[model samples]
Target: MLVLPAVVAALSIIFAVLTVGINFNLIHSIFIRKSLNKSKSLTLFYLRFVIDGFLGLQNAIMSTFILLKFLEVEYDEPVEFLFWISWTSMNCFNVRGILVIVISLDRTLAVFMPISYHNFRRRIRNFYLAIIPLSWPIVNNIVLWGVCQFRVNIPPGCVIFTCQMNQCYISYALSFEVVSHAIIALTSLILAVKLFIWNHCTQKGPKSRDLERANYLALIDTLIIIIFDIVPAGFTVKFPALSAQFGSLILVCKMSGYALESWLVRRALKRTNDIVSVSYANNSSMIKSTGQASSNHRHHRHINNHAWQ
Candidate 1:
């Protein structure tokens, strides 16, 4: 049973690496880079990109730690310190959740208000947006550090679990998760409603099609985040003794979301390329038709000149 967690942790590490790779690729892509030049929404997405990257790295390291501890890998470090580090990382998962909420809100504004979204300055938004996501992690770490220091008892060899800890830690953490999940769920619902409304109100032209596609992608991503947060965290709260197992389950869902997002990005990029190709072909055909029309007009003029002569 212990080995099951270790195996899941290994798979988590692999997917976390994939998540990091895809996020970095997105950061470097032409669209993102161009957005850096053109859009305030880029700042929001850059924050999301950073948050996702941090989550991936955090998951990888913590999962590795979990695996090593499960295998009873020898380490000179004190058990208390190991426990502190692992649980602190686990608590910081709230920061990731809150960031998703920020992302959902930011995207909501962008999608619903094109005029305001485009007019917004990146500098102003970036400062505030950066503070929002960054602050939660700092506050979460502090609270987590305080709780673990004051509440937890560390067994000599096992860093992952100890016999006794105050209920405050679980209660506080669970409340945070539940509240964050509710907000995300609400945001997802709002986005879905707006998406449907937008589709119905708009004509089925290229512009509307593009907007629908973007909205649907954002809607799906938000839903995935909600699912990953709610299910495993709910189980963890319900079965605190099996937190390690539930944590592993959460990591699995996180990795699955990462994989799904990567696929979405690839699909979006492919669609963009296809649209551009079709546009280019249309332009080329139009130009060819214009040129042939001109050539025929010239040929007719030449025939009239010969007949007049």
Candidate 2:
């Protein structure tokens, strides 16, 4: 028991640090470096990375606390703090689920309705659309907290074991998680199949290939979320005892998934930047060569006129 918690805590911290670092770079690249286009999809991705960073931090702290408790370290687990963390983590989780759906929809639109997608993004430069996902969890958690107060069998500490105390909230959250993930998975699968057929049936240009790549990336991202985040949530709802035994490990897996996603996005951004830079360089060279050729042509015409005169 002690060994498991200790190892999990270490892994959690390592992945948490990695996640934060990679996500920071991803945010900087997207917002600062301007490696990707300013579209709704990238906006949602930015929000996702921000939430991922927070989740990673929360997991690290919670894992450390769990390890300390297991090691018999003399420390107090404040109920208020634990409850706050639990509540905030739940809210972040909900936001992430919404984000996954939005991301999938964004990709699907880009593939199926390219012109409309481009025009809509051009018109909506602000992040007003993001408020939907951001505000959903706030409303949900308020209702949950209000209902939990009426429950007679409240847990002593609002930590890992608190799910049993707030059965209603747990059930609602788990169901939402599972259902949302299922929808996202189905959407991604259909989108992937459609994109595959489209690509196979037609001769595609660079723009088409880029869209294809984006769709595939979205598909991979959804897969990671389903495997690590959704599966764990479903299993926790079905086997609550499993959560108590392997909560730290589950957190580790979640962090690992986020870390992997951050890395993939970072690499994609770098590749895009490289391609853009090379294209710009080539265009500049072509323009310079054209200018020189025009100048030589003009000089030759001037000499010919003087000789004829």
Q: lDDT (CA) for every model shown?
A: 0.66, 0.73
| Tens-digit per-residue lDDT, 1-309, candidate 1 | 377777877888888888777776667664555422223334555556655666677677766776786677877646566665566555446656776677677667766787777577333556776677667766665665575455556656553422324465656666787887788788878888876777688736556444445555567667776666577767766887777653467777777687667657556755765776788899999999999999999999999999999
The runs of at least 3 residues in candidate 2 whose Cα sits more than 4 Å from the true structure, single-residue gaps closed, are: 33-41, 115-126, 150-158, 161-165, 203-214, 233-247
In model 2, state the lDDT of residue 72.
Answer: 63
Candidate 2 clashing pairs, residues 3+ apart or interchain: none
Per-residue CA lDDT of model 2 for 1-309, tens digit only, reads: 467667777787788889888887677766798665444445667788889888877776766676676666766666566666756777787888887887788788777788888898668653775787888877685667686553434354334534434767766776786788888988888888877877788646655435655676788788898888878766766887766565465677888888888888777757766777798899999999999999999999999999999
Error (Å) of candidate 1 at residue 138 is 3.9
